[model samples]
Target: MDARKTIVIGVANGRGAGDPACQDGPEVLRSLKFLADLEQTHAGFSWDDPIRLAPGESSTPLDAVVQIGTQLAERVCSHLRQGNFPLVVGGDHSCAIGTWPGVKRVLGDKVRLGLIWFDAHMDSHTFDSSPSKRIHGMALACLLGIGDRRLADVADAGAKLLAADVCLIGVRSFESAEAALLAKLGARIYFMDEIRRRGLREVFAEALQRVGEHTAGYGISIDLDALDPAEEPGVGSPVAGGLSLGELTEALTQAHGDEKLLALEIVEYNPYRDTHFVTARAIHDLCQSLIP
Candidate 1:
């Protein structure tokens, strides 16, 4: 398989973020014409239209999120089967509820998978623990097989990731219970303070090593909010102190060269909240680095 063969899955479900504007995340990114721009400089890249709930589809918020997840799972799985890497862009963090599971589905139950989550929140909430009860906040929990069974079943095989194989970075806005859950699950969290102290290069090198050591490969999920609000202000949940655009871009560029990097997903970008397309331009640059 050609390593450059890439499939882009755009998921436009905002129910998880509880912000209707987030549903336009994909469209916002598309408006930048990143793929078209990439084709001029790179080869073997293709894109699919953003996935959306059908007209008149009836489902609760949780159910709708899960459904979109399942749809994304199918797309990711198919791309993987053909030996193509799946790059998913999302309406919210909840898109991981399906993205990671789709990777697991492609690998089957016998193989183990790992995750590297770059985000401001742990995204480990449950209905019982969530202050807002938004599905986006609970995505990582669902991926680790801790939330509702409906979400846990998104992969159809089982939980897409294991706590021992997962790592979270730039976490500075999580609920107390969410932090506790990460501890209970044994997932590593690299808070903003540590990243600032150790620096992004060292921190990201450690993260890649930790997640890559035990598994065949790992899927990386980047929530735009993981970056400082000043740099990526258009996220669904913005945190004040976070990684800088240069730090994130440099770290990601280094990581993108890994042969064990199986899939990539970027989420929670809200164009409506952006000031003069700062977030959109950042997203465009990030995609350019990864695709080329």
Candidate 2:
């Protein structure tokens, strides 16, 4: 693999700063040896400078995060148009609002973009339905053409992803109203129960097929909380009974080979809560899988 084929962007905007540990996530990954490993194992892979939140900004402030993220998105989109794969290492799930728009801008309407969201929470909440109004939970809603107008208008010339092209994977818990809204929009969803019965292979296969069917290419947005708390405890909202590290690795290995996979974003890594940097290592390994 050509080293130039991959462009990794580390976004260090700790939106859920209630736990300061997230702010150190990017550095933790670097400290744990992700950068050196990528260079040695995948010759063509390299990372861009980490994009951090503006100093003194509040994470829960939806408008502020949106502005910072939109600027970051522009940088990421530029790389994508150059045909370099973007591997976004995130501060929180809210980063997707900016990252997805960048992907859309590069692809335009020439290719339909499918979203594969891996998370325990639905992340489909609009401001009205959000209990805490944390921007992290509402990122997906913003990307899907609903939510704060400022965020909804992030894509180039004011475009957002069509709901029909989005799919939610591993969602086991969500607000009732958000669930109904997702159902109404006809979003494809594979809940935990469904995954348990069909198995990860079949479920992942179906997810890729659904995204492929609707668009020319797809973007994968993974929230670490989608993994079981026991396996990945360094997340803001740790959920029980989530996928294990091995299960997630298998799913990613398959997805990385898909021709239609255009971009990938991994978010919500809180190093403060992590046990001996296990989560950081897991993230590094996942990135390695995708590069080659």
Candidate 3:
């Protein structure tokens, strides 16, 4: 097996989620020396220093989001151009506004990129559909070319990921408006109940086949909240009856070395709500599973 060269980018802006504590997530993982530990655990894997956005760029949340998104896109595109896997650790799920678009930008018009979103919430709300006006909740919608133009056009307006090419996994919480939009858009969703009925491996295999069948490659955006709060308690948005850690890790491990897995983002880690770094450790384990 060839060594996997990965680029780790960290965005410490919590303004997108309307929660400041999430900004501390990247620092928490860094402070714990997570990357060094990974290097020691796995051979043929190496990571670059995390790219982070500067603080106090703007007081207005949208402006801050755009700034971070622009910088993140540049960094991610650079890594992709260098033939490295981009592993993004976020300030919140909102960082996804930049993550996927960056991948799309690099792949350009010829490649159809599928997106697999693993989250407790649907995260498909538009500005009008969102009751909280939180960008974090509306990231998937934007990536699919549906939300505010500012966000939806972050990477390349015409290069949006198609809704049909996207799949939502482990979603257990959502508003009626978001659900209606997803149904209208004809998006594929694998709720926790369906996952349980069909079996995790079966459901994930189907999802992978669906997403990768028509696309050149796909990106995975994992919101920690997708896991049961009992298992991952440090997420900003916690919902009960989410996927178990074992199930998620197993899926990731199964998909680990697929050449079609182009990008990965793990978001919504709030150390303030955690007990004994459980969330961080879980993230570390998941990263381990992805390492080649």
Candidate 4:
């Protein structure tokens, strides 16, 4: 084992839900023995008492989601400073704003940070580009320093990552404007076609290499929509032709080798959309694999 303690954060803020059932995702996973199984698989792994954001209060006008996200990020940052591996379970993809700051605080100017975003959608929409203006769609842009000021400022002053340092994986669907912006920003993207041609192993290896090359460490953010809709129907955005659960597990397991990995955040699990806890179990399994 790496000797670094594993700390799981169950963020129960559900403002980003496409369906209301997502609000209960954390509790559903807990009731299904997600924590117990994780402990059984990795002796030293344990869950932190979940942090709950009040339902209506928010610190930002953009949405309550961003406010709660900031709160979550602060907690995650504190955990990393204590030498713990922070595993954030999500209410929505918007939580990445909260998650990335912790890494920024730890590495500071010493290391640039890279972001590996696994999702079916580009998640690169900005307020001007998105028709719906959903916060979830804008998260990637926020982290890359191009969205609402509140979100873009989540990281420490001058510590945010550049667009070149982010790699989008398993992106098979994207809005036209989002695609154009992504191209303009020169971000690296490995779509489903590329994954099929190169294989998951090579794809993940290349992604890690690219991100780790310039940064001291990188963040791993997986939106359940990156998985085939059949495998992860619980997500807010369900896209077809995505990675299988097995492939996702393998990629995440390999990511543990980078001692500089700051944290892992999983988002968009909607319990209302799920049938019989299928997505939750897959998420639990992935968490178990990454614990060591």
Candidate with best TM-score? 1
The CA lDDT of each predicted structure is 0.84, 0.78, 0.83, 0.79
Q: Candidate 4: lDDT of 115?
A: 88
- C-alpha displacement of 110 in model 2, angstroms? 4.4
Backbone clashes, each candidate? 0, 4, 0, 1
lDDT of 3 by residue, 165-249 (tens): 8899998889999999889988899999999898888888888888898898898889999999987899988899999888889
TM-score of each: 0.96, 0.93, 0.95, 0.93
Candidate 4: residue 150 lDDT (0-100): 74
Highest-lDDT candidate? 1
Tell me the lDDT of model 2 at 246.
87
| Candidate achieving higher TM-score, 1 or 4 | 1
For residues 1-292, write the lDDT of model 2, one tens digit per residue.
2334777788877763345456567777766665576777665677788887667765556656777578778977998778788888878887888888888887776667889899998888887998877778888888877877876777554545777888888898889978987888888888999999988778988888888896878888888888898988888788899988888788778876555788888888988888877888778777765654
lDDT per residue, candidate 1, 117-234, as tens digits?
9998999999999989999999999888887899878858456778989999999998899999989889999999899899988888888888888887888899999989976788
Summing lDDT over every window of 10 consecutive residues in candidate 1, give the lowest-scoring window.
34-43
Please give the ranking of all candidate structures by lDDT, highest first, separated by commas. Answer: 1, 3, 4, 2
